[model samples]
Target: MIKIEGFQTILYSLVDVIDSGIHIIDTKGRTIVYNKKMAEIEGMESDEVLGKKIHEIFKFKEETESTLIRALHSGKKTENSKQTYFNNLGQEITTINNTFPIMDQNQRIIGAIEVAKDITNLERLIKDNILNKGDTKYTFDSIIGTSENFLEVIEKSKRSTRTTSSILIVGETGTGKELFAQSIHNGSSRSTHPFISQNCAALPDSLIEGILFGTKKGAFTGSIERPGLFEQAQGGTILLDEINSLNPNLQAKLLRALQERTIRRVGDTKDKKIDVRVIATINEDPIDAIANDHLRKDLYYRLSVVSLFIPPLRERKEDIPLLAQSFIEKFNALFELNIEGISEDVYALFYDYDWPGNVRELEHIIEGAMNLLEPGDTKISPNHLPALFKKKAHLEEAPASKDEDHNKRETQESTLSLDDYIANTEKQYLEKVLKEHGMNISQAAKTLNISRQSLQYRLKKYQVK
Candidate 1:
């Protein structure tokens, strides 16, 4: 038999080495052991917390919120519960905690233990990664705004962090839907696991299927056994960006995946169980998407159990300066420029203009301005703006009368050479169709009513990348 002292040494060793914070309290609510990790997380010295009464420290917090307190009073186990509060040092803390009552050989409650994993840095990383880089990234803090409408979405997302539910993020391009998805995942209980996203509109149906659900060995030439996005995201989150671009067949398959919590490799007969939370995003309104048959009704009902819309930049113009400052700071590091800020003229012009490309357009404009600035330049002025802005401003000043339409028609007629016009018009049509389908060549070709080969020839002919 192992000696009691040796056994005690092993138990204490196990507690000290683990990554999660550990706090143990006796039956009388007096702290027995506060491990190194726990001391670090609570921002206190072991001497300060050990032997202190937990009831005295957490008496006013919450009955259900504090797992240790609940276990102390009710003699019940609590698992994976989220709690947020300030520590003794006044540092705000958020953690997912698991607490249980220590039991004796006779099944009597002897003490209580609390285990917590801190994700403070993870949340910060998620926000920091999204600064002006346009990467598929975000957390609630990554999103910048104080507008009432914008903050409401943040509040809604904050509330969502408390549960595990499939969500649908609706927003136009550049409105930061992916950022919100990242924030939601980071704040969730599964924050320690992988967070993956697939752009549904970016590939053909056959390729998308293999990429998302994996492919079996010998299923097809060059196809190796693999775990698709759903399997890869087991115990975590998967974000399907542009979900409406998925074909009806894939939509049906996705519906089953969500309902059953299982997925099968592309050519495998066996099904694999997976624990994954999906967050789907769409640029269009759900009703509009369903009405157009672009998104399935059943899929909509399932994925949209929780839905959030990111207000467009035009709707939240008050946030422009804040967003611009963030972009300035970001680009300063990226371009190695020390430009301090934007000028009053540039700010005024930004307000007067309509941002067609939304926040993304603003970023591009700032980047363009930076490109023209000298090392000595400290601020972005109107003169540093793209020449197009000056031309557009002049045009905006002109009154829109019948004469304006006549002038527009005259300009359109005068600008096109017969051959150039045909080539330009064809290119415009192809580009629009390609963009509409998220650059899926097969889908774009089908919408254009042209053979894939024919569309290929035209694309090569026009040199469309």
Candidate 2:
């Protein structure tokens, strides 16, 4: 056995790691154990109850249902009992308890242990309907932009909500494909049903197949009858994110499900009919995807009945201010801060930077800036923004004298061809910019004066970090 100073240390570690609140009492009804989770649920420290009685910690509503006092009296088990009480700070709390007598080897009652589960907020979750909780209800107005290009995509996505046919949304990561999908579902006839989503790139083929089509009992060891995501989304929508990530074999099965409107669970011969509308997304060019054998031509046609391509944020730079303002408003209400807006310098820096992660990255930057605001701060200034932003802006607008002095040393090189020299110079500049930015992708994109997509492509082309 491993040596330790005392067994109390081992017991303390085990109690703190548990999910539920655990409390144990001795035969004398004095508290011998109270864990950290119990403290959080009770809004009191463990020291408050370490050596106290049940009456000293909380006001019990029903002594029989709420306390170990009953177990101490009867020396019998109490299963699934519930209790309600007001904490020291007057916060209403609800919890269910499982209290039972702890007996020693002599079959004599020693103490009682109670496992408490805080169900205060869970009641609200049950009322809101957990099945529909994950589904977003974004409509056409949910997308914020007025540019003609953006408006066109919105109009197409809105039109897609009018039909039950398959849809294929193609865009770079974080281009709001899920937003578009949610809008379509909320506006469709299936609005009252459910909308579920899964990322194909996140799981392996064998597991993904079972999650998509479900499994029957005896299919494998520990397998039981369960409904897959498609079944759960009946009469609604199911988005297969990064559709190209699916293995070819699974792609064939998904195509069959679409064509026949039926799916067979793993190890089950019977086919179950489903009415889930499929919306698939891919970030790469469709033609390239086909050539690379990442997607089958037939499956592509099946899902592209109403294709919607979302343009990256770089293509719609005019919307940056609007998006930033919207994020500021969201955080202002969320954080209860008095921040009004961003400064002009911040706006200029935002325009100069290429958003590689699209709208999502912009939102995160605004959130981070808002979090740094002082209690009395009115608007977000350059100092409030992340350091990466300031560095990128400085590098992009650096003095031209630095480049001028370096160019003076070149003699119109004769050894290298003109195209080769230009290519080499471009490679060296990208590497230098990337090194200066030091993993700050947003800053690097801004410094290069190019879209995040182009920067990534150039980095790959030159084999640079």
Candidate 3:
């Protein structure tokens, strides 16, 4: 009898440490014992939960109609099944429950003991995996690109999602800064929470304050007690695009909110604490913005705790083909076109021309090309490209003027030999690439797919900086 009792005690002790929530209910539907995890899921202490009626303690509606209770009363065992219930704190929880009737040696039912494994996280993982496999309509996966630079940005952003640090994205306009901010939020632990954005440049100085840190009722002509972006983004992320556009006064307020993690409504004296991850984007040089008094220096420092710079399309020409291919595939699926690929001349044209508008311009050009191509067209030729490219090609094809006229004509005509023309084009392209790579020879060479020594030879031959 002593050995049997010790074995029963060991079994009960093991049940307490099993991670899942375990509960034992008497025949009258009263909770006789609640494990530590069961109390945690209900957001309560074991002392307050134990010996209380299961329904009254947890305040769970389903406990009253629990299959475990019914099975115990009917003198049968309840098999494993899945169910969803709200805890004491009213958070939805999913559980895979197994319940069995407590019985004597003769198998007479007395009560029931339930072991419920919380499966909320598991459910979310499955759902996220499925959603990730689909169209990716509103997420980071939709930001299409396969360039090394773009892939590096994606990898860094993925790392950022694992933390709660403030992220500052610095890039020129139309560089998809906001898209990256949203992508980071979607990949974060707060994915299920709100991801709010406010463009500082879009609001007037007179209205920006109220829009961000909302006003209270009677605070102004039309003011009412309203939650601001900070409040709405609690437990999530708030993306402040064009953060440098905010005036000094608003910048001070924003800085305080970020530092203190609290905000005060327009008419409220009390500060309300908030839990929000801030992600700010700036199109201008942050240092220049501060020096020019367009942005507050202190605010700029705070926002740039983790800064990421996105290179423009002109800077990463090697990525042009990859970005173009991605855009072509996207448009083909969207428009149901079977256009195969870009022609060799079209690819060369893209390589030759500068993309002033960055990736956004590239996407538009691809869409236009897809529209021009027919169903049976295997390749999108240079003619199918925009008028600008065709114009450039025509300029490249024009014959050289005679030597007598060359001196009288423009400088471009004076040195219009095939070698000189090629040299000039190469110089223009190389100079742009060099500037984009911050004058780093190895990086520029790698971007151009040329040897560093080869790039140096060209640089010396053309007298390029």
Candidate 4:
């Protein structure tokens, strides 16, 4: 049994701890409850807002624009509607709001409460791209690649511009997947229309649906009838960057849209036709993404109408000189310097080093070295290079110690019994898989094709965390 006062305190504590912003107002529109999260979201103090009316703290264009006010007056609930308004500081704030009218036993509206999820950053990205009129920064000719495999990929991408089919680009991060995507869109016949590129991993699952499929006004509290990315990119191309990170349910919806050539907005009954060309990129192998359950197999088939794989920098080492010179020229214009190029020693270090970050890393390294060049220095030598390259050079040039060599030989010669070796190998594999899945027991178990309990038992037997 709990006292009424204690129960109220418990409720208040729970509300304060909630991740979403919460604000409650009486029938007269005077704010009675303002949680910490709400204060943070609005950039206001609760004490300042406590006795004030909703309109006093927030600047809504109309009374109806305030979901709390609308719910209080109309006795209607609004859920999952997006609201854009100004706080007291005049800073524009965007939130997904759910407002409900608090009614008495007689069914009369007494007060209203609003729960808001902050989505300002995500909203800014959508707004910036939605009205974009087919302007793209990169083209097929802009792509700097001369390697046989990379050139073949570029040629294939150029040929793909003839068709309106979906394209999937598979590559490591910073390997210029979006560059290829923009190039394809520019070369295609639909180059005159809008080109919108959205990273799928940018927003939460709750907001991404409305962003991708659009929303109907009555769908939720403050939701307006807005067009989604697919609608905005109609007759053009919508590039879904890091498509593997998209929610599985959204992937199914994407597949349906791709297959039917139509998309139904969120909370809408009717499907609308769209002529958007979908281009999706994944930082990892699609097959591995599917096997790890990060991507859907059926959706993969739908998206991979034409697939382009960009080779990593290490695999195409011959392009280093061209890429390095290109970056030098770019930096020369930016810094107003006329640095000629890189030296052979620097090129040797670059080739010897495995560029884990791919082309982007090379460009950054060049920029760093150029920034360090003296007034008379025309070339990027080993000394002008960053500390990372210097360290790599030191490690490569250093002679191995006899003690270290002896230990390596001893470890190589030592062997375990057959059963022991098998168990050790199994343990190593389990640890590797666990690390791959971020030590998520259930996902690792699923990948290993074993029951959770069985995996747990093995983990216990091996004392693996």
The model with the greatest TM-score is 4
Q: Model 1, stretches more than 4 Å misplaced?
A: 1-137, 392-465
Q: lDDT by residue for model 3 over 275-372, one digit each (tens)?
A: 99999998866655777898887887788777777766765677777777788788889998877778887877777776667788878888877778
lDDT of 2 by residue, 1-465 (tens): 645756778878999999889989998888898988888888888787889877766675653344687787689776655567776666767776778888999989898898888766643433455423255867778799887778988998887887899999988898899999988999889888889888889765746787789888867633568777788888889999999999999999999999999999987999999999999999876755887999998999899898887878877889998898889888989998877788898888788887878999899889888888887899898888876766755744546586775675464455678867987898898888878988676799998676575576556445465
Of the pair 2 and 4, which is ahead by TM-score?
4
Q: What is the lDDT, from 0 to 100, of the residue 90 in candidate 2? A: 66
Q: lDDT value for candidate 2?
A: 0.81
lDDT winner:
4
The TM-score between candidate 3 and the true structure equals: 0.56
Cα lDDT tens digits, model 4, 9-68, are 999999999998999999899999999999998899989899898877788766437888
Model 4 regions lying over 4 Å from their true place: 1-10, 26-28, 63-65, 70-76, 103-110, 130-134, 387-399, 402-465
Query: On a 0 to 1 TM-score scale, where does candidate 1 land against the true structure?
Result: 0.57
lDDT per residue (tens digit) for residues 1-465 in model 1: 999999999999999999989998888788898899987877878887778886445423443355676797788886755566666656766666788998899989989898987755533433464211123356676889999878988999999988888899988899888889889888889888888877888666746787788889867533467667777778888889999999999999999988988898988999899998899999876765887999999999899888887777877789999999999999999999898899988888888776767888888888888899976899998888888866765533656799888998889878889977888888888988999999999999889886564576466446576
User: Sorted on TM-score, highest at the top, how do the candidates line up?
Assistant: 4, 2, 1, 3
**Which of the two, 3 or 4, has more lDDT?**
4
The TM-score, computed over Cα atoms with residue i paired to residue i, of candidate 2 is: 0.60
Candidate 4 clashes: the total is 1
> Which of the two candidates, 1 or 3, achieves a greater lDDT against the reference?
1
